[model samples]
Target chain A: MVQLSACLLRKIPGPPRIYKRLQTFRLNARYEGRSRNCYVVGQGYQLKSMQYTRVARKNKVLDFKELYNLRLEAAAEEHGIPFRYLWDGLRRMNILLNRKVLQDIAIYEPRTFAGFCELSKQHQVDQGLNLPPHSYPKIPVNTKGML
Target chain B: MHDRRRVLQWATFARSWWIFDANHQCPFQSANRLCLFLEGKHKPIYHPLSDCGDHVIVINTKHIAMPDRFWRAWRHFHHTQYAGGFQVQRAWQVHREDPTKILKKQIYSTLTGNLLRKGLMARLHLFPEEDVPEGMLRNVSNQIRQVMPVPKTLEDYPIEERESFPRVFEWPEEYVVKDGKEFERQKEYLDEDLSLSKLQ
Candidate 1:
C-alpha cells in the first residue's frame, strides 16, 4: 500500500478534528450490533463486518465533496501519475472517470493512462486554437471592403 | 560455468528454506531472515541474466492488514465495456476471492520489467488455509509463532469515535433493510407495491 507522505497530507488541509471524531462515533454506532468477526482468517483478521458497514454507511450519507477529495488522492497514487496531471486530465476530459477506474489503471495498466494524457493534451491544444496560422508571411494585406 | 554454479547454489539455498521445522512458524522471517537475508539486488553474485532469488511459500494469504484508513477508502474497478460499463469493488473483495493475487501483484509491481519476473513469480506459493500441499509436509510440526499485536492508531479506531462518519441511512432516500424481521416485512410491502403499480 502506498503511504501518503507527510508533505502531501500537509498540502490537503484536513477537516476539523472534532468533525472527524464525530464521524468515527457515528460509524461505530451504526455497526454496534453487527458481527465484527465475520471475515477473520487464520491468526489475523480478514475483512471485518464493521469496516464494510462503516464504508457503506459513509457512502450513502456523506456528500460527494469528501468522497471526491478522497478519490483525487486515490487517483494520484493508483495511477502512479502526479496529482496535478490527474487534476488537469479530469478537467480536460470533461468526463468523470471515477476514483476506482483511475486507481486500477494506476496499478495495473499505466501505459494506457499515458495514452489518455496525450489525447487530453491534444484536445486542449485544438480547443485553444481560434484560427490557423498562415504558412507564408502576409504580403502587405489591404482590406478592400473596409476601404 | 562459474555463473551457473553460483545460480545453482542460490537456488539450492532457497529450496532448503522450504522445510518446516518445530521452532519456526514462518522460517523465512524468523530462522532464516527470509525477508532480510535473501539479498537479490544487493548481492555481487546477482546477475540480471537470471532470477536468482529464493522461492517464497506463504502459508496464509488472507490475513495481511493495511495501515489505518486504507480499508475504508480504497476502491478498485473493472471495466465491462458494454451498457453497464464499469463495475467498482473494494480491495477487501479482491483479497477475499484470491489472496495470492495481492502478493503476486505487489511482487510484480516491484520487479523490473523483464522476463525474469515471470520465472520468479512462478516460484511463489500462496495458500489461503493452514493445509500445506501433500507430500510437502514431511514430519513437520506446526509450531505457530506468537505475533506481537500492535495497538490501533487514532485513525484505526472504530468509526463511532470519528465525527465525520456519516449516518446509516440519510433522510429522503428510500432504502430497504435486509437480513432481519424488518427485511421480511419490507419484502412483502415491496411486492405489494409492485403488484399495485402493475394493476394501475
Candidate 2:
C-alpha cells in the first residue's frame, strides 16, 4: 500500500507557477466569455479586469452618493437653504442623518424634510453665517423706475 | 373636477407679490422674515430647484430702524481690488450713501448661496421711501406683517385720550407745579448746546 501511494505521488508532476496562473486566467476568461463577449484570455488581462471591476464597483457607490446629494439639494432648496448650508448645519447641530437616509426622507416624508431644512436655516441664522461675496448681484439700477 | 384641479394647480404655482412697510421696523429681523417668502418657504409646494418664490416690494427703507447703536458701530467693508483699496464705513455712513443698502445686505446675507440667488434677489423691490413706482405698486396683491410693531409715541396719542386717562391721585391745592417752568429752562439749555455744537 505504501509503494502504491508513493508511485501515485511521483506520477503527479508539480506544475510551474505560470501554468497555475494560466489555468486561473483560462477559468476567468471562460467565465467572462460566457457572461460577457470579450475573451482576452491571459494572466495580465485577468488581473487588469479584476482591478477594473473593483474600481467600477467603487465608482458606482460614489455615483449613488452624488445622486443622493443632488436629490437632497433639490429638496433643501424648496425649504429655502442650499445643500451645502443644510449639510453644514446638520454637521454643526450633530443631526447625524446620512445622505441616503436624508434623501429618502426628502422623498417619502417631504414635510419632515422641510422641517430639517428649516432647522438648518435657523441654525445658520443663529450662527450668523453669511454666503460668499458676490454670491448674489446688487439691486438693479432703476433710473426708469419701471419695476 | 378635473378643471378645478387644473386651476388649483396653476394657483399653487403662481407667483404672488407681497408688500412690506419697512417704516420703524428692524431691518435685520424684517430681512429674516422676508427671506422666507423670497425662497418660497411660505408655500406648501416650494421646491428649491423650481422658480416658485414670490415677489416682494419693500417701501420706506429710508425709515428702517437699527437696533441699539448699530448705525454708528456696525461697519460695512469694501475692497476695490487695488493695492491699499480696503475701505470700511460705519452703518450710518453706508445708509447715508444708500438708504436701502443695509436692509438689502441683511436680506442678501440671509438667502442661501445658489444659482437662483440672483434671480430671487431680483424679485425684491426696495424703495428708499414710501414712493414705490406705480407699475410695481399695481402688482402687489398681499401685505407682509411687520416683524415688530411700531412703538406709539406720545404724539401718536390723541389729546382726548391723554386727558381722559384716569388720574391715580389728586394733588393738594397748595402743591406747587415746579416742573413746568424747569422743563422750559432745560429746553433752552439743550437748544444752546445744539447751537454751540453746530458752531464748532
Candidate 3:
C-alpha cells in the first residue's frame, strides 16, 4: 500500500497540501478512482480516453418512458421483490436522491445499489410502512396558448 | 366647466393609486399593480376598442429592492436559437449596470397579451433617482396633477407623502391674473378672436 501510494503521487504531481497531510494519518488507505487523475506506475492512464468514456457513459441513449419503467422492472427481476416493496422502501428511506443517480448505480454498481435497497428495506421495517401497488397517473396534455 | 368635470371624474374613477418610493423595499409589487391598472383591467370605463387607462410614473427606480441572493442565484436565460443555444446573466450585474433597463423589461413582460401594451409602456416614466429638477417639474406639474391621486399603500406611496404630498410642479400662488408676461403668454395661446393670418 505504501509503494502504491508513492507510485500514485509520482504520476500525478501538485495534489493539494491538505491531501498530503491526510495521507500521513491514513492507516488503511483505499484509493477511490473518482479524482481528475489516477496513476498506477510509469504506465500512466490515458487522460483523454478516460474523459471520453465518462462523457460517452453520460450520453448513452435511453428512452425516457423506458427508463422510468425499468426502475420497477429491475427491482422485481433482480431481487424477486414486488414493485410496491421497492418503491415504499425508497420513500421510507427519505433520501433526496434523484432517479438518475439510482439508475446509474443500478446499471454500473449493482452491489452498492443492492446495499441501498437493503438500507431502504430496513427503514421501511423500522417505520412499519405498508407498500401499495404502483400506478402511473395520466398527465393532461397542455395545448392552451400554444403557437 | 365640462373639462373640469371630466378631470374630476377621472380622479374618482381611478381604482388604485401608487406612489413609488426610493427608500421602500419591494417596489415591484407596486410596479406590477400599476401595470395591471394600465392594462385597463381595473376600470369600468375600459373598452377593448379604445385604449383608456391611468398614467403611471415610476419614481426612484435606482433604489429598488433586490433579494440578498439575487446576485448569485438569480439568472435570466435567453436563447440565441430555437434549439440548444442559450445565455445566462445574473440579476445584480444587470442592476449595477442599468437598473432602469431591467425594470422596463420586467414591466413589459407583465403587460403582454394586451393590444394597448406598447401605448401604455410609452407613457411609463422611469426616474433613476428621487430628486426632480424644479424647472422641469413646474412645466410637467399640470399634467401630473391631472393624473395624480391620493396615496394608498405605504409600500406603493412615495416617502414624501409622510410630510404631505409634494407637488412635482405647482404654479406660484403670488402670480396674479394681470396682463403680466405669464398672463399674456396664456392669452396668446387661448385667444379665440385672433385670426390665423394675424398670428402668422
**Which one is best on DockQ?**
2
Which candidate tops TM-score? 2
How would you encode candidate 2's per-residue C-alpha lDDT over B1-200 as one tens digit per residue?
79987896787678899999999999889998898889876654445678779999999999988999887578788889999787777786578689999999989989998888999999999999888889888989988878888989778999999889899988899998665488567655755665422422
Query: How do these models rank on TM-score, best leading?
Result: 2, 3, 1
Q: Model 1, A55-139: lDDT tens per residue?
A: 8887865554444444344434232333455456567667578655654554346566555544443443444522112211123
Candidate 3, which segments miss by more than 4 Å at Cα? Answer: A1-147, B1-19, B79-85, B133-200
Q: How do the residues A27-80 of candidate 2 rate in per-residue lDDT, one tens digit apiece?
A: 575554433333334555667778999999999999877667756766775555
Instruction: Report lDDT (Cα) of residue A120, candidate 3.
Output: 53
lDDT of each: 0.46, 0.76, 0.53
In the range B1-200, model 1's lDDT, one tens digit per residue, is: 69987896655334322421212132113322222112232222333353445544556555555445554345556678898676655555556568656545655555566766676666555566567767555533222222224446667777777756667956565766454488567655755665422422
Model 2 clash pairs are A77-B48, A78-B48
Q: Write the per-residue lDDT of candidate 3 for residues B1-200, one digit (tens) a residue.
A: 69987897676454343344433344445556666456654432334454655555566677666556654456666778867566666665466567676677777877776666788887676777867555434434222211223335656666677558656876699976654488556654645575423432
DockQ, cand. 2: 0.05
Model 3 chain B — which ten-residue stretch has the worst lDDT? B141-150
TM-score of each: 0.32, 0.51, 0.34
In model 1, how large is the Cα lDDT of residue B152? 63
| Over 4 Å off, model 1 | A1-147, B1-39, B42-44, B80-84, B137-200
